[model samples]
Target chain A: MPVIGGLHRTLKGKAALFILLLSVIGLGTLAAMFLRTQREMLAEFEAERMQIVEHFVVGTLKPVMLTGHADLMSGIMASLHSAPGVQSLAIVRTNGIEAFTDDATMKKVNDRLGENRFSRILKEPVQIVPAGDPMLKRAVESGKSDFVRRDVAGDGTVTSLMYPIANEEPCHACHGDDHKVRGVLVATFGLSASEAGTLQSMFWFSGIAFVLLLLTAALTYLFIVRIMAGRVSNIVDQVNRIVEEDRFDKRIVIDADDEVGQLAISFNHFISSVEIYRIEEGREKERLEQTVFERTRELREKNDFIESDLKLARRIQQNLMPEKFPTPPEADFHAAYLPCLHIGGDYYDVFEMPNRHVGVFMADASGHGSSAALLVSIVKAIVSTAGKDISSPSYVVQIINNTLAKLTPDDSFVTLFYGVINLANGKMSYSLAGHPPPMVYNRDSGELQYLQTNGSLVGVFDFDRFEDSEYIFQHGDRLLVFTDGLVEAMGEDGKMFGRERLAELFKDARYERPDAMTRHLLDSLASYTGGAALADDVTLLVVDYKKG
Target chain B: MKITMRVAGDVTILDMIGNMKSPADLEDFSGAVNAELDQNHLKLLLNFKDVGFVNSSGLGRLVLAAKKIGDKSGHLKVVNLAPDLDELFTFTRLKEKIGVFKAEDEALRSFQ
Candidate 1:
């Protein structure tokens, strides 16, 4: 299996082996036929020799036999037997005996001659063969000549012929016309040494020639296979080098215009395409990198510009709030503002109105960032100018609302809680415009209340109105007003720091000064939010009524 | 927020879902209102059964939508407010400008 497997390892090797097998079969058959034909010709030549000798014996002995010269016939047969390559010669009588061995047939033949010319029968006339020999019997019965080949101990090989002598009119007188065959001439001749040697030479020559032919075919096939293998190996080596070096530009050499050469050309074409694609891919990658670099630089520059502008806006917005609140003897004020972004919409202010009245203002414009910041600025301007003289909180709020409603978009609005606390009487009048109610905690009664009032969002409806809600302020009554951001700050569980929590904080911090109370509220809010960033602007304004 | 529109008689019912907090929610609610107003379907009912919280920004959008409908001489009303949102509406006096109904049928009947 391994030998056969080796033979068919490659296309060339398999093809060569196939051709070698065909040649061996063809030459082997040819040599076999040649030897067979030579053997048959040698056999026919030996048979022809026997028939000629048989004809000579019959022609010479028949006339001599008719003259009844038995001695003379014996001499002739003996001389023919002694000729070259003749092993034995004999004439057999029809009675299954040698012709001269039987006295009756001899006597009958002598009487027919009418002279006793064959009186003395030749003793042992060249023993023809056994009487029961099938060749001799068949020749006698069929009246025809037959031959057989036999290997003899002394002479290597010989052909034995049994020729039947016909009972013609002349032979009838001696045999009495009873048998159709008068006798059989039995002859055996050794094969000619020269002729055998020639045939053996021919056999050797055919065998050697066939071997040479097969050898030539095999060598030719091997030579072709070696040549093809070398070329293929060369191509393989070149391809390996190209792959190892990562050189797509190199092409395999096409030496011949055969299948192997075609493979080389195809590989070259593949390499060419790879080279082109690699080049294009490299160029595309470079182009993409360049584009990304440029875009990144441009975006970085724009981001820097926006960051700077936001910082400046934040500072301006911070400046808009009151630096210090009015310290009227009736109340101690504290406030904290934290923007969710660089700028915020939440605003708060504390200023002396008139005659010991403190004006307190807090507003949260809808939305946040730049747009909401702009809205709160407008609110500050209107409230500052309008509330300076007019003490009616609702009337001042109405003026601001009408101005903003005409000036801002329909979706733009502010929620504000503005109040005037007259320190002399400890009375406060405030308008709550869409704002969360402020918590008022009283120290004396230990009661917490919300100054809840209803007012639509400013700047949404042109005809929208706001009215004042009155609250009586007492000493130790602390008021906490805040934007929705403080209460709506979401905890990790998505729950809000709601109004109830703020109310609790405000009540808990009742004994603390307004500043300490505001700090506690913010700290609680920070705790509620788990220190996460606020999602909206937060503003806390704590005002404690200190009048006694 | 996801808003699906249906009709009960002449009133177009906008079933509001999710918190109307983000600016995108503002756009969605206002867009639904504008779409109804564009079709001249004056009677609008906003179903708030599935609504969660409405932030200040969200409140502003609601007012804007109401104002738009009012400017077009069409009525935009809301129903099925959660308790908190109902109090919110009361506190903000949004109920003064936009109708608040306890039920879809009652709101739809108001369009008559």
Candidate 2:
């Protein structure tokens, strides 16, 4: 899960990088140590070989010098010259001259032995040891062998040994025994190394280190990548599969008890929790759905019952209206009622009154629905009973108002225009109570007049007075009285059909029969409103007086 | 419709905006009136300058508000009625029960 330098690297990649880094550091350290150890061992081997050669030269030269085998000293020089690491060899006398170069001493020793073995003839060049050389002085004075090592140009190193031959009793047999030291043997050994050889060794060491590093890396890959990372990858694949398939029931397989195995176990525990949650969520969803379905069913049943009751109420309210208006030869009547709901607040009725008069009643109670229907029902009852006996329309309305004021609530009231028309004399007495003025159109003159009056709404104040306004009904005169809902019906544009439009429609339909005029007006209303549902109860009544 | 209430002297003025055509509008108008009356600030004046229309239901609610104020031994008045609503008040004879004034000061003075 760790990010390096804004890049997301997997666990295996980090492991491989870590192992490679360690291997590189280890390889470098091992190479340096191997190089240092190689150089040290070479130095030690060269020093040991130089010491052996020094001892060999001293031991071989002692017997030969004692036996007066001076020619054998040339053999010794030849042997030292033919040696592998030997550069040059010389025998220094007491006076720092080559011992064999003193021909007098050599002839004395050789004539005493009767041989030409001590011949003074020089076969090779002499190598002079530097006069002030520290090893030479030390070896000559102490009568011991000493060596000094120095780096020579281009040929590696040269080790020079000064071996002092002591003036012993045996060596004094030929020469005078006056001196403590006889001569020193100086030999230089070359520890030479070729560039090709160094390169070969270096190449071998590098190759071995490289092979060892490769082997370690291969094992690391096998263990980390193949075993550890492989299991982790398997766990990742399993998790991905579970997510893609949406199967929380499946789990990662546990292969070992290592870290990766523990990770798989943790993942499996998480999956189990998810699976349990999924099951519980499914059950909760089912329970919620079932509860909602049951509640909806119960609500629907209640709504259906209420709808049925409302339909029954509508039928009863419709029955309360005059199904057939009084068909007198003196006048013709037509009415249309459209409720905003199943029942309406607007009511109208046409029936015969006393003295050859026709009674016309239309009322709109305030507010709507069942409350308005109840108020309207009370008005209908009052009118059919008390109105039948009262000769004055104003007196009848006063009675209705007093009765309603006692029965209805303080906030509730009704607007009604009631009229009693004398079919015999064309005298119509009407009272407008908190209602919109109805239009009276003269079909003969084509003149329109609104029957306006100032009267308060019914049932609000029992002390309020009602007055009668009279309009003479003549031949070819039509009256259209309606509730406010007729004028206040809204169109799609939020404008009402309005009193102006209603009056215009009344004038236009002056020539039509009462029934046809009402239908035409309602059709125009439906058209103006785009046949949308009404927001209020609309009640329209048309009375045409066609006198014979 | 939204009703904004302000106090002018002893009278609580309710500024009725928008046409009181919907049932919600009726409730808002009645609620504002009832709330003022409940607080015993009963000398109320309804400012009807912005009211465009009032259907019968809205008229009923207004009547209910007036009756409520009247029953509380307080006065309710209206001012700045639109032309049509003034005519409505005239014919319906609501002007007889509640005072209709052309200006706020006239209605507020009538409260005394």
Considering every candidate listed, which one attains the maximal DockQ?
1
Every candidate's fraction of true contacts kept comes to: 0.71, 0.67
Q: Each model's C-alpha lDDT?
A: 0.81, 0.81
Which regions in candidate 1 have their CA more than 4 angstroms from the true location? Answer: A1-240, B2-17, B23-44, B102-106
lDDT by residue (tens digit), candidate 2, A1-548: 22231122444467566767776777777767776676666667778888887778777778887875667776877787778777778888755666776666677866765666555666443438666667777888898777778864432567877888887777655765766777888788856556426644775677577758766876666465556655676688788889889999888889889888899999999999999999999999999999999999999999998787677657666877787998898888998888786466788999888778888999888876667778888889888887775367888788878988888887789999999898998888889999999888898988889897757989888678999989897778898998887887889898879888888888888778888888999999999999999888888898888882
Candidate 1 C-alpha lDDT tens digits along A1-548: 33333433654566667767877778778778877777777667766776676677678777877654567777888788787767777788754577777677667767886877667664654445766777777887788888777754422357777778777666665666665887887777766656567657867687778778777977787887777766777777787789889998888888989999998998898889989999999999999999999999999998888787677657657877998877766678999987885455889999887687888999988876667778888888887788875368988888889988988887889899999888898888899998888888889999888887757788788877788889989877888899988878898889888888788778877778777877888888888788898888889998888785
- Candidate 1: which pairs clash? none
- Candidate 1: DockQ? 0.57
CAPRI tier of model 2: medium
Chain A TM-score per candidate? 0.61, 0.62
Give per-residue lDDT, candidate 2, residue A64. Answer: 82
What docking class should model 1 receive?
Answer: medium
Each candidate's B-chain TM-score, in sequence, is: 0.95, 0.97
Q: How far out, in Å, is residue A481 in model 2?
A: 0.6
